[model samples]
Target chain A: MSKLYESQKLALWYFSVALVLFGAQLLFGLLAAYQYLNPDFLYGVLDFSINRMLHINAMIVWLIMGFMGGVYWFLPIETGREVVGIKLAKLAFFVLVAAVAVVVLVYLLVQTGKGDFFTLWFITEGREYIEAPRWADWGIVAVMLVFYFNVVATVIKSKKLTGILGVLIIDLLALAGLYLAGMYFTPNISVDQFWWWWVVHLWVEATWEVLVGVLMAWALMTVLGTPRKIVEAWLYLEVFLVFGTGILGLGHHYFWIGTPEYWLGIGGFFSALEPIPLVAMVVHAIYDAGSHKLRAANKPALFWIMAQAFGNFVGAGMWGFMHTLPQINLYSHGTQITPAHGHLAFFGAYVTANLVLMYIAIQRVRAPEGPALDSRAWKLAYVGFVITIFGMVGALTVAGFAQIFVERAVGGATWSAYIAGQEHPWVREPMYWRFGFGVLFLLSYLILIYDMLTIGKRAATATEVKPA
Target chain B: MIQGVEVLYLIGAGLVFIAGAGLYALLYAYGKIKGSILLQRSSYLFALAMLGGVAYIVAHPAFDTFWKSLLTVCGLTYLFIPKSMLWVMERVHLREEEERKKEKHNPFYTNY
Candidate 1:
């Protein structure tokens, strides 16, 4: 067995926590889908709003956890030194996990709007994904500060300043900066919406894009022995592309939110451009793999990387572009189209990025030579990936299109009318499809977690069984 | 109600579009070029120029429909140029590799 680094053990613990949260996220996702089919499925026990909040909150928290874990694992390797403040890193993990636990407990138990400030602190700010209470937000920010300090200190101490490290550090700092935008509360809806996009759009489309690029570049170089020059060049291009286009892409959300008419053109045009980087990434990976005859070691990692590329293109890129236009978004704004894009985009972009990181960490610790193609875990994971991807894309696309057609295209324009239209058979039927697919998605994650846990043990047993 | 300077801006947008297309062509020919350092450098410069143009446009007077259209076209062109470049370069590289493989296997071929 390969000797694991101490920092890597911290990463594994983070991954284990993230995996559990991922499973919890899927459970809440299924519950939300179930509510769509049968609104009374868990009416009082777990309301739709609560379920949806849990789902989104769990996803955002877990993905951040995954990113933090990945940073800890890769930073030491890139720096050629032990992680600075190892104790602080572990503390950050525990603090974050504890914060999540408190938030989840509060979300499940406490009811909001009791006219009490204490409830507000414990319950939430009541915004969509930023629903975590003020206290939870403070906890998250605190943990993030510790993580940021550790990463920055490590980089500053290192002699070499690689392009990947530069991008990662800048991106992490920006992530911390942008997250503060969500903490401020205001009565002005337009101002609130503007800053919210600073957190949401910037984090998802801009900062996270840079993070993914650098991390993916590093992984490709480390695993495939791809030339650093080429990967670094692509990283630079990605930074240019993301910041140049993605910042203006925020104009898209500004469209119907009482913002200026000019945002319509800016948002539509710039957001349309957002997909170009994703497409470039997919092409970059394909070309790099073809040009280099590197060993296909760590097949699962490679598969997830490709999935990250293609999935982001389709989910965040294509699906996002679909409704990003002012005309289309005018109709699809609050409809199921939003959630459809949300599900696929988040899954494709962040979820697969985390999975790729996890697979890399797993391959490093468990199977340095590479896991066998026909290993039970690998086979099951492949099936799980396919089922989850198809399940999400198929169900969500059907649901979103059905929503646009029934609620907006045919029905009248008012919000009440849209809500009434959702009751129609056409709209509600596709939701059942989403529910079914959600089950498959949950099952896929269960299989993935099992595979993650047992792959090393099974490999060791196989080696023992073989003749020496 | 297009001013003379706005017309110049429109013309500048057109020029940028053409420049973007030209950059795409250069990127497509990346394999034939000895090194991509120049290509990479040009991409950065192009990105900087685009940022400058965006700043200039945004800082000017209120954006009418025509100006909005101009900016929109410029942004779209800016977005696709690099992507198209990457796509074309990959294809060109693949084609070159295939040709090299064919040349190597030719029975009549001899190393100098």
Candidate 2:
């Protein structure tokens, strides 16, 4: 009964890997943005295809790791059972890491065109199934199965299912669909674009959104002492709003992909509905906090969960919905506005959830004494969330909205056209303001890393009475 | 577009929507009465109808455009599902009933 949930440790391992990927993503993002201003910034060092792949791939991996960790940390508590198998959980983690490494290797090899990997998928002389050197894709599938087995075994043994299970099962099924869809895609750019969004855009906005929403509800209940009944009720309501509006939200991605005009309505209407769950989450979180007078056992974790709920609404829901109108998405899809969705949705729905879970993980492992937490550390993390998320959102939105005019209306007529059309106006900002905001975000990451590492005390603390 | 094959597409879509709406209405009524059994039955039936509608849209050549197929599919799904979405609505148990007694005795929370 007292066995430690090995799943949490495995999740943490993935979290570390995710952070490394994030660092790489950040570097690529900076370079990608800079290329607009200076197309030849790193001509030989970074290939566009490779860097874009890494940026998008890393972002996806990081979000997945974060969600996995959050689920691992919180599921047991929600279900009132210790994790079933420790060894299988650890095995799954190693498999995933190996899979990720294989992917990076394959991506690099294909970029160089130095091997048989390039023509394997669509052309002849492709790698044979087990012998094809396409180990990465196989590795990923294997990893998924391993994880599915472990999670399923645990759920069956526990004999108790949380709302988390409902959302999780759907995501798992969606993952299978996405993978299959990816394989079946042809080489046509427009068709590729359509299929690509089915996997990438739909996964994040629709499937993952449901999982994140349900998990947040569970987290709110755990940290804020909200009754399970209320949280469960909210989850039920959220499912209707999420699926009713979410499944077709993928149509938002279909606008510029040579798809038909009718999708505009499907995408537009559903994208508008995308905000419903986000707003519901905010309402649920607030109601929980107010009901308990903002009393939280782990205040920092609670803060992040709430922050995630808020940012998700504003960034993904509000900003995104505004651009979902056919006319707007038509102009906004490839512009800076896409980044506005990327920045907020990534941080708000995924990163924020992980941050809260990380705090909780630190607490459980450290076994803090009494009600006293490391206040400085908590403040540092909260501040980190603020600076990074706020800067990214603010800058990206301005850049996005500004690009609309240059790209669509003016069509790059002159010097202003060349500059604005070519890139976001990051260079146009006052030097001091840009420097200040940029430095603030860098410092925020540094502070966050420091805070998380230093959460544990030096010596064993005296035991405190457990709460009932 | 309203020729023989096109008219067949329209008819198929119409039937899917009508069946879906009927099932959804039944679920909504059952939900209002707080009858979990009837609600669950309606939900399953409605989901089947929705899936069938999506299939119809996908197979029909006249509705091959991404936008139209997506709209009709989504419309059919929403139309078939009850507005309250009782399938997903958690029952707010105000007090214990004979059937509720089973869940109340579930050892997970009490044993902990």
Mind giving the per-residue lDDT tens digits that candidate 1 earns over A1-468? 566666778988988898989988889988888888778887888899898889888888888888878888888887878788889888878888888898888888865446356665877777778887888888888888888888888888877678788888888889999999997767899888989889988998899888888878777765555555556767898899889889999999899888888898889778757766765665565455545532356666667776777677667765676566575566667766677678777877888889888877876676554344224666676677667666766666665556666566555456776776677676677777778777877777877887787666665555556622
What lDDT does candidate 1 reach at residue B81?
A: 55
Off by more than 4 A, model 2? A1-3, A31-39, A75-86, A105-134, A412-420, A423-439, A456-468, B1-112
* Chain A TM-score vs. truth, each candidate: 0.94, 0.85
Q: Write the per-residue lDDT of candidate 1 for residues B11-72, one digit (tens) a residue.
A: 24433433343344334334324356676566556555555545455445545565556556
Off by over 4 Å in 1: A292-295, A370-374, A461-468, B1-84, B87-112
Candidate 2's clash total is 2
Clashing pairs in 2: A262-B67, A263-B67
TM-score of 2: 0.73
- State the lDDT of candidate 2 residue by residue for B1-112, as single tens digits: 2232333233344345434544444454444545467665766676577456546554655444654555455555455344433333324323212234544332111211
Model 2 error, position A135 (Å): 3.1
Best by lDDT: 1
